[model samples]
Target: MENNIHGKVVAITGASSGIGEATAIMLAAKGAKVVLGARRKARLEALVKRIRVDGGEAICLETDIRQHNDLLRLVSLARETYGRLDVMVNNAGIARLSRIDDIRVSEWEEMIDVNLKGTLYGIAAALPVFKEQGSGHIINIISTSGIKIVPLQGVYAGTKNAIRTIAEALRQESAGLYRVTGISPGLVNTEMPDHITNEAARSAVKERAAQIGVTPHAIAGVVAYAISQPDNVDVGDIVIRPSVQD
Candidate 1:
C-alpha cells in the first residue's frame, strides 16, 4: 500500500465482492477513504467495519447500479462523508453469457442494464462532480472477453467493448478537467459468473476458472496504479489477463 492513495476519496460500485471489494480494501489500506456501493448491505457493512478496524476510513451506501438515483446516492455519500470524491470506480457488472440462439432475452436485458447502462449511470452520477472539482478519475472495469470474442460470450463481450469505447471517447473530451480509464481484466477468480444462465457455458467458464484464473486483487492493483499517476499523466487503457489465458 503506497501513500499515493492517502487522503483521496474513492467510491466504488459493485463493492460487495470480487474486483470491486479487493480494490476497496487495497485503496483503503493505502489511506483512501472508500465509499462502498452495492446491493448487498451486509457485505458492504462488513467491509466498512474491517477497514475502520484497520485504521482506514470507509462508508457503505447500498446501491443497485441499475437505478440511476442509487448511483446518485453513492456519489453523494462519498462527498457528504469525506468532503470530496477523487475517484469513482465503475466496477459493477453482470455477465449472463449465452449464445444468441438460446434467445435468453431476459438475461441479455439484465446484462445490458447491469453492465452497460449501470456503468453509464455511474458516470452520470460522478461526471458533474468531477467537472466541478476540475480533477477526478473514472475507472471502468471492462473485460478481456471483449478483446478476444468467443462463442456464447457475444453479448457479454459487446457490453464490455461498449464501455471500452466509451472510455476512449471520454478521455478525448475530458482535456484537463478529468481522467477516464478502462481496466480490462481477464479470467480473474470471482463470483461474477454465477449469473450465467446457460448450463454449458457456466460449466465451461467454471472449468477455465479452475485452471488459470488469478485473484481479483491483481486487477485492484491496476486500478490503484491508474489513479496513482500524476495529474499530467493519464492512463487511458489497461488490459490485465492471466499469462495462460489464451
Candidate 2:
C-alpha cells in the first residue's frame, strides 16, 4: 500500500519552530526530503541536524518570506537539491491583536506584509515550477481567526481571509493542474502569542493558549494526512482546532 508521501520533496517556510518544525519532522520521518526556510539561521540549522540524526533527509536556508527573492531561493533550493519539488508550505505568519480604534498602523502593515504579501510571494515562486512539472501542492497555514472574526483580530483576520479567498480561487483555476489546500488552525501552542505587541492581549492569548491549545504535532498530523492522499484527491480546506474551541 503506497502512502503517497515517501520520496516527495517538501519545502516549508517558518520551519524553525512550532507547526512548521513539527510538520518538517513528521514528513521527513515519513520519507519526504524536506527543505526548511526561516529567518532564524540557528534554529534552521538545529532542525536540519535533528532531522538528519533521525535518519531523515533535510536541509535549511535563512529565508524571510517578506522577501519575494527569498521564497524564490527556497523553491530553487528544493529543486536544485532534490530534482523536483512536491509541496510548498507557506506557514509563516504573525498576529498583533488590538481594537480597531487602537489604530496600530505599523503593526497592521507588518501583518499585511508577512501574512498576506509573503503568502503571495510564495505562490508566485511555486506556481511556475508546479505549472512546469504539471503537478504540485501548495499548502497555506491559515487561522480560524478568519472564520470567527472578533474585535481585536480585525486586521489579522483580514489578512487570513484574503489568503483564504486566493486559495479557493487558485483551487478552482487549477483545473487539476495542481493541488491547493488551506489548513485553518484555531489555537496551537506556538510562539505566535509571544509576538503580540499589546501587553494585555498577549497575556490573555498566552493564558488561553496554555489552557486549550493543541500541540503542533496535531496540526502536523493534519498536514501529513493531506499530503499522503493520492494526487488526484485534493483536500481543499481543513479547520483543525481543539474540540472545545468556540
Candidate 3:
C-alpha cells in the first residue's frame, strides 16, 4: 500500500455538509476517490457534482447514519465502486444541547443513536472489509465538548466521549490490522447549532460559533493529515479547537 491520500477510496458519512463535506472535498482534491453519504439527497448530489467538476472522482448516497443498513451500503458502495474501502469516516453527529433537568428524553435518544450507535455501526460495517483486506482506517468525528464538560451539553458530550473511548479500544484491538482515529473538534462553523431545539441554547451556541468557530476545512485538513500517514503510524486522538476556545 502506498499509504498516501492519492488513489485511496474513502467513505464519509454525514458528508452533505460541515466537516464531512469539507473532508470529502479535501480528500478528493488530493486524488482520493471519495464516497459520500448523508440524509439530504439533493445536497449530496450537488456536492458530488462539485467534486466531479473539480476533476475529482466522487460518488454520493443518501445515508441516514442512524440506520445500520445505511452504513453497510455506504461501505459496500465504496468497495463496489473503487475496488476497496481504504478509510471509513464516521462524521455524522448531532448535538441537542439541554440541561439534564430538561428531561429531553427524545433528544437524548437521538444523540445516542446518531453519535454513539452510529459510530458503532460504521465500525461494524467496515471491520469485516478491513479484516479481509488487512488494511483500513476508521475516523470518528468527536467533539471537544466531551473533553470540557459544560452547561447544557452533558448528554451530547457523553455521546462523543463514548465514541472516544470506543475508538481507543478499537485501535488497541486492531493494532497492526488497521488504524483508528478520534477527531474531537471544538466550536466549528457548522449546522450543528441549528439542530438545538432549545431556543436559548441554540442562540448562545450560534453566537459563540460565529465569534470563535474555525472553518470546517480546518478539521478536514487534520483528517487529511491523519490519513496521509504511513500505515504503521496511527494518529490516536486529535483535539482541534479555536485558539481562543475555553
Top TM-score model: 2
Model 3 spans with C-alpha error above 4 angstroms: 1-3
lDDT of 1 by residue, 137-182 (tens): 9999999988999998899899999989888888899976898989
Would you list the clashing residue pairs of candidate 1? Answer: 38-63
What are the models' TM-scores? 0.97, 0.99, 0.98
Instruction: Return the TM-score for candidate 3, rounded to 2 decimals.
Output: 0.98
Best-fitting candidate, measured by lDDT? 2
lDDT of 2 by residue, 1-246 (tens): 238889999999999999999999999999999999999999999999999999999999999999999999999999999999989999999999999899999999999999999999999999999999999999999999999989899999999999999999999999989999999999898888999999999999999999999999999999999999999999999999999998
Off by over 4 Å in 1: 1-3
Of candidate 1, the 10-residue stretch with the lowest lDDT total is: 1-10
Model 2 CA deviation exceeding 4 Å by range: none
Residue 192, model 2: lDDT of 88
Error of 3 at 85 (Å): 0.1
Q: For all the candidates, what are their Cα RMSDs to the real structure?
A: 1.2, 0.8, 1.2
Worst lDDT 10-window in candidate 3: 1-10
Give residue 83's lDDT in candidate 1 (0 to 100). 82
Model 3: per-residue lDDT, tens digit, 22-51?
999999999999999999999999999999
Q: After superposition, how far is residue 35 of candidate 1 from its true place, in Å?
A: 0.4
